[model samples]
Target: MRTIVAQDVVSASKFNRFHLLVFLWCFYAIGFDGFDIAMYGVGLPWMMEEWNLSALQAGAVGSYSLFGMMVGALVLAPVADKFGRKNVIIICMFLFSAFTLAAGLSPNITMFTIMRFIAAIGMGGLMPNCISLMTEYSPKKQRALLVGAIYIGYALGGILASLIGMYLVPQTDWRVLYYIGAIPLLTIPFFIKQFPESLSYYLARQQVGKVVEILNKVKPDGNFSEKDDYQLHTALKDGKGFPVKKLFTNKRAFTTIAFWIAIFCTMMMAYGLNTWLPKIMQSSGFSLTSSLSFNIMLCVGQIAGTLIGGYLAGKIGYRKVLVSLYLMGVVTFIALSITTNVALVYFLIFLGGASTVGAMNLGNPYITEFYPREIRATGMGYAQAIGRIGSILAPTLIAMLLVTGIDPKMAFATFAVPSILAVLGYLLVQEKYGSFDKVVEENGMNEEFIEGENKRIIQS
Candidate 1:
């Protein structure tokens, strides 16, 4: 009987067309999420003016969507582990695309905020699952670089939103952007037909046939077939039990909490800029055009930072890179707050984007690598869901500071505080807690694997 090791096959496989196809799936979906996020920021100044909204009211409107994103991250993303990643991704895309279009047609601020909240649920759910999917498929050697590459799609989406907003929001209306968001709905059916399911998800369910099918595609030369006998001693054991509780097992609790804190700060920085930077730039005495230009620069810097972070992470380590990024955020935000020169301001904003959203893009792959395959999606979800609290708060807090007649410089400086905390959070994480670490805390060395009664984390 032919035997297949699901974990071995995937990790040892070479990158090919199949891998690139998977990248496209994740990249395009995440790009749409980024585009929707930028829409709100681009539309915010106009939305407030159109509705005669106070600063507090506009902040509340922004929080509504973040609230939805938090709910979806906490609730929907984990469902992918059960129902399958591909299914959940398709559901999220449908809802996100449909509701975004609905938001544009909204007759009042009340209706618009409600629609945005619903659409954002999809965006929130989609982000973590895509990260999980991409991480699972990536060869361990190139994982960080591939994850970083997909995020370029996210940055490009932001650039697309900014460019469209620069022209359309001023010429016709912000609604035009939302109309374009619905375009994803048309492509969902095609993805459903072509997208592949998670190999481990099938293995966990004891569906060897599906596992064989996926392995065949991932490495077509392997000649995998349903007829092959499989020995998934790891999957059968690890797959049992609730994925969430298992996160605390093997003395992983502290590292889990540290990741949560770090991600929370990352989101706080990322969403703060995505939602409020343009307005912050305007309030700092820049023109409307230049303010929007600053946001574009922020996205451009993200692409640069993500690629650099990925490369540096491979050479040094992500933990060090992450801390450095946070420190960069601290310095750039402080400098940006005080700088008056156009060239200097742009440079600071670029670094701020790198340290903020760019750092966030890299953080996901880092977290996923630490987690075992069975709980990868759940692990990423909890971090982002908890982190969403910071994301949810940033818009309102920035708005409150703006309304309080505080110095715009001081308001910008507040972001520096979280970056400082994030530095500490990343530092506290124990490297031994990582899934791939051979010397784990559980045994002070890798625990011996004994299937059935004695199995632990399945080696991914």
Candidate 2:
């Protein structure tokens, strides 16, 4: 595992065939991840129409999926730590893909909802592990950039969903779309064989020989500066026992709770807005095209925002940047709710997308920073799993409000409170321990902690 961790510093130019292949595999995983995420969003309208579901029922469907995702995030993340990231990835992909494909074959609303719920579990579980895996193998200098790039696959998938809706939905049924989305699963088998085990995981377990073997496969030419001097250590800092328990007991407990709150709030706002934007717009006297295009505008903004946020995160501290970004989301969401002008709405959408989307990206990296390597995945999973609660509840809450005849603008505007609150949460995070890279610094406390444990920390 130390050897795998040692290989973490390879220059981009040194990334040979195996690197390229792994990047593509991760990319493909992300693409499919995107597809599955958007599937319910795209199908919601049609499903509502066919089943004569009220706004509340439609919202419930979304909530169900989010609830399932929360379960997966909470449950699978720690399992990844206890088991292995690669195995978790494979199992999750299978679970999600199979359920998603089955969603296409559902004979009734109940059955369809069940399938979506199951698939959401797979969707939630895969994200952190993928982020962790990619980061584990990527070069250190390019860690943020690579993570950002991997996230682009998610945006690309959203765009693909929009494109499919634009071109295919009018001509074909939504079920066909589900079938097309499921097609990406074919890559899972390929990845299982080809995807490398996280070296950091091996090293943490003191399996030095296995780490060396895996490193050799990635660098056949033997160019990595394999040195015993380059000791690998876990970034975890809590007590030596089960890391999950330490999350609440250690110095990081306060910060961890803060992050989870921020995640919950932001996700509630994000999912709520994404789910209800069209309805809100229609209430504001917009046509279907204009309302639908609102989402496209948001996606464009998300892509642009992620890029800008990634750059800023590199320049400033991750904590500072994330706080500012969440604040931006708070302000923009309120602006979006009040603005009547289409152009201003689009502008706010872009800016909000930029800031809030980046906040979403911060979860994995932030988790990587907060916990030691020994329990990194566990920490991330717990955060994400808990965070999924906000996402799961958003839709149902919004639906209930809509049923109550709450003003559309006012309904969505309520979400802005959370974004602002998230800024507060981020500020509470200790700047000294707010980034994963801090653990990599010379003579850092995390290093000492890892040495005592004699384990390698895997980060992605």
| Top TM-score hit | 1
User: What's the lDDT for all of these models?
Assistant: 0.84, 0.69
Q: TM-score each candidate.
A: 0.93, 0.87
- Candidate 1 similarity to native, TM-score: 0.93
Tens digits of per-residue lDDT for model 1, 410-441: 77788899999999999998877677522122
Report how far residue 341 has shifted in candidate 1, in Å: 1.2
Worst 10 residues of 1 by lDDT: 437-446
Q: Report the C-alpha lDDT of model 2 over 114-166, residue by residue, as the tens digit.
A: 99899888888888788777766665555666666677777677667766765
Error of 1 at 43 (Å): 0.7
Clashes of each: 0, 9
